[model samples]
Target: MRHRVGPRHARRPAPTLLRGIYLPRSMDAGAHAMTTFGIPLLVLATTNSAVLTGVAFALEWVPRLAAFALAGAMVDRYGASPVFRTASVLRALTVVAAALALPYSDGVGATVTVMLLAASTGVLSEFSYIAAETAGGAASRAAGSRAHRVQSVLLGIDQVGTLAGPALAGLLLERYGATGMLTVIAGFSLLAGLLAPRQRDGRAAGLPEPVMKGLRTGWSTMRSLPTLCWLVVGLTLSNLAVGLLQAAAPVIVIQHMGRSSADVGMIWSVAAVATLVAVALWRRAIDRYGLWPVGAVAAAIAATTCLAVTLTHTYTTYLVLIAVLMAAEGGMTVMLRTLRSHLIPASAFGSTLALSALILLAPFPVAGVLIAVTPPALLVHVMTGCAVLQAVGLAVTFARLRAAPGLRTALA
Candidate 1:
């Protein structure tokens, strides 16, 4: 009789998931950030109108925010590979079309063209992102007990992309003009599409779900998972405080603190570094202390730093506090991602991911409204109010999680 191989030994060798999934993800994310940030600056340059620039910002983000649910549904129905590849290819084409159109258009025509490009790309980017996120979620689930390590690395990769993307966008725009910058973005987007892994054969592709129905499904998934719901609630409150601080950063730095616009960028650069460090540390921390304790500690640190930021009189102090706050947030994010992979069923992962993201992001526009209406001198006070709410909410959330009998195995 011939010798038989065990299942593990018989499995075919494959490229590491990190190289196959995350490398392309980084390219996609950076390109999206470049286009999103670059377009507003381009609008300002082309129109010489701050109003149009502000319009460009809204056009870019509003559509992106709207696309999450639909994109998530598409990912669930069709699978991540096909959705990501199609959206990325379409995004590249859109950018190239805009670049080709820009030279011929003049004044209002140029402004309109750019705004349309922003809206289109914004929607496409969300589709790609949701698909990629679903793909990552599948990979995390396969990792089983080591899932948080996967999540920490993924979060770290995102932080790096976010840190580098804007600066790269500005540099390319300054050196190469609209066409050059757009062309570079298109290249990255195309590369991301080309690099995406092929879909596995076993998963079924189905008819597109209605957007509203998909959202309802996502909502149902959340309702089924009380632990996930409570974590989202705490994070949403934390984000409200973070969002207020972010929206108020430029005004506080340039007007209240008497710092240049350049300093605002520097502050974020520092904070991003802090976040990266925290993400790196989370894996080891989780290994030693487990997820719940690590998350609770992170929450406490974030809440403390958020409150302390209100007392800062100097730019340096504000910068340090913000960095610490972001670091803590990074740790919490890793914990969230790990838990999400464990809790949400694979069948609803895409749709539920969309709903969770929407909830987390809802605070941003609210923060923007607060910043727009509040006096600069009162910004700290607004942040203080948000911080207190975040602290109490998270404290309560963790306390509940700790006491809940249903969550012990999952948290363990």
Candidate 2:
């Protein structure tokens, strides 16, 4: 497909690698590192219970099922930049509060309270992210490619931070305690907040209509597009598998394999590094075969690799399988994101993209709960089976869409 700017807006100069791209990439790396690493370690160190850890994870994701629609509406109404900046500041403050509250929580109630607050802030930050990317025109195949490149680089950096954050958290916990580690997280969050500038494009100004109206419009557009809807379905099932695996893997590794928390972190770090390499190499793959085929292949690879994890009896084999799983997930994620951008319209960008999250991420809580209750072996089997089904479903849907004359015309 050819990439072209529409006549409705005059074409601006092509974005530079330095100014237009690298700045947001840097911001994402810092923000993701602080949240992904800090939140889990803080809970693990403070609460120190698997049940509570599961609760914390649930609190973080459960509300996104509902709130994302409204957040998307707000983005469409107010524009993305202001909301993005405001959410970042709020997230930074929330991190600071959780840091402060870490020492005071002696039991489940206090820990739950602190966790809920942190989780809520994370949702807000996520909403802002969806809005910003959508408003930046990251949905078009051409625009999406640029966004994917930025994400690839940022995620590669985030892998480094993932390795660093847990190790740093462990050391800080040993030295200055949980409070010291949290303080460092807060500092990093505040710095990320400070770096956010107003929208580089003028899309952040005046609303075109009421928030409700915009949402309806976006919904109508999405329903009219079968490929996009099926894509959301595929993504939702994929996320369910991921959530189950994440919740179950630690228990399996620790209980079955007799490993320590440090071992879990190390295994995850190996996966992260593998993901970084896969994402770096994925651009070439995308450039060669296009996003759809690459995404389907990646999904199949992910399902098989995750299933292989359940079969491994040795640590070295387990680590290798996990790394392969992470690499496949990383590569698939890049393609899925780019595909979402290509399918959605510019005007309804945030709300439309938010729907993808609403569908995919909303089920995570249930998945986590199932993991907490089910046997590890059974859970692994279920997760792998679901992943295989999702991969097959996505492949079939893509084939059907590709064969449809109407879709071909619309996409053309």
Q: lDDT of each structure?
A: 0.80, 0.63
Q: Which stretches of candidate 1 lie over 4 Å from their true place?
A: 1-15, 35-58, 99-118, 173-181, 200-206, 250-263, 310-315, 373-378, 405-412
- In candidate 2, which residue pairs clash? 139-341, 139-342
Error of 2 at 109 (Å): 4.9
Cα lDDT tens digits, model 2, 112-158, are: 75587657756865765665565444523454336556555545655
Cα lDDT of model 1 by residue, 280-390, tens digit: 787788877777877899999999999999888899999999889989999889888988888999999989999998888777657756765666567778889999999
- C-alpha TM-score for every candidate: 0.84, 0.81
The alpha-carbon root-mean-square deviation between model 1 and the true structure, to one decimal in Å, is 4.5
Listed per candidate, the RMSD to the true structure in angstroms reads: 4.5, 6.6
Candidate 2 residue runs with Cα over 4 Å from true position: 1-21, 135-176, 199-215, 375-378, 401-412
